[model samples]
Target: MSGYAYVTAEGLKKLRAEVEQLERIERPSISRQIGEAIDKGDLSENAEYDAAKEAQGLLEAKISRLRGILANSRIIDETKIDTSKVQMMNKVTIKNQKNGAVMTYTLVSETEADFKQGKLSINTPIAKGLMGKLVGDVVEIQVPNGLIPFEIVDISL
Candidate 1:
């Protein structure tokens, strides 16, 4: 069975905005760069031409992947979420059972997870272990370091 991609409405909107930006600005800019490089003459030894071509290919691939994600995106309705249990779109606060350190993370889709922003992907080891668990329950999660125990302190929208 294929896993569902749980994304927030704002995250989906951002993806759409990025698609528009690539179509309107980035694609044209790359095309212009390629054209200018081509005008510089020798295609065989032109480093600029080669670089531009590579960039264009990478850009197209990125655009394609983004479009695919947008096509498959399921925007999560945050308002309808049940705050009784840990689920997608839940802001969960967990405390390390061993160390007594607490960290709060918002479980989100892979596309919506920004580690820098404290959002963890639903597919991640920690999030997967926490899913469906209730508050006050300790779940053992396997990280690269090894399995560690974390107690679910709270769950909220």
Candidate 2:
């Protein structure tokens, strides 16, 4: 499916760094492996050559995919995002209706999502349901288990 990829400044930086590493370090390392494998003798029986070829293929695939992602990425301005409404880059606090449990999550781009840090991807079910919701609004989200109701308690940058 074709869709826009949103990314934060930090996420963009990380992507650039990764691309640089692949070009500067990983590319050369993999090339060296291939060269050494070629020097080892027969290609049909050389396991090292086969493995190196596989590794090079995987690395090239990764590099291509990442480049595509970067090309389509749109960097989000955290400060300019609308806090008045639930949107990308907004830190939203919600309360579960069933258990009265409160949770805080920053709605971010797919690349920026780090669940351990409470940063959720905008593509997530919960985040999709939460988008455009206002504070004090009760949002009902559909999940595998069923529908979950949550009240938007707060929103910030």
**The candidate that achieves the highest lDDT relative to the unseen native structure:** 2
Total backbone clashes of candidate 2, pairs 3 or more residues apart or in separate chains? 0
Report how far off residue 103 is in candidate 2 (Å).
Answer: 1.2
Residue 117's C-alpha lDDT in candidate 1? 88
Models 1 onward score TM values of: 0.94, 0.89
- Candidate closest to the true structure, highest TM-score: 1
Per-residue CA lDDT of model 1 for 1-157, tens digit only, reads: 1455567889989989998999899999999999999999989999998998999899999999888888777877778999799998899999988889999999988888998888999889999999999999999999998889999999997
Off by over 4 Å in 1: 1-4
Pairs that collide in candidate 2 are none
Residues 1-157, model 2: lDDT tens digits: 2677899888999988898899899989989998999998899999998998899999999898888889998888777888889999999999999889999999988878999999999999999999999999999999887899999999997
Candidate 2 lDDT (Cα, 0 to 1) = 0.91
Indicate the TM-score of model 1: 0.94
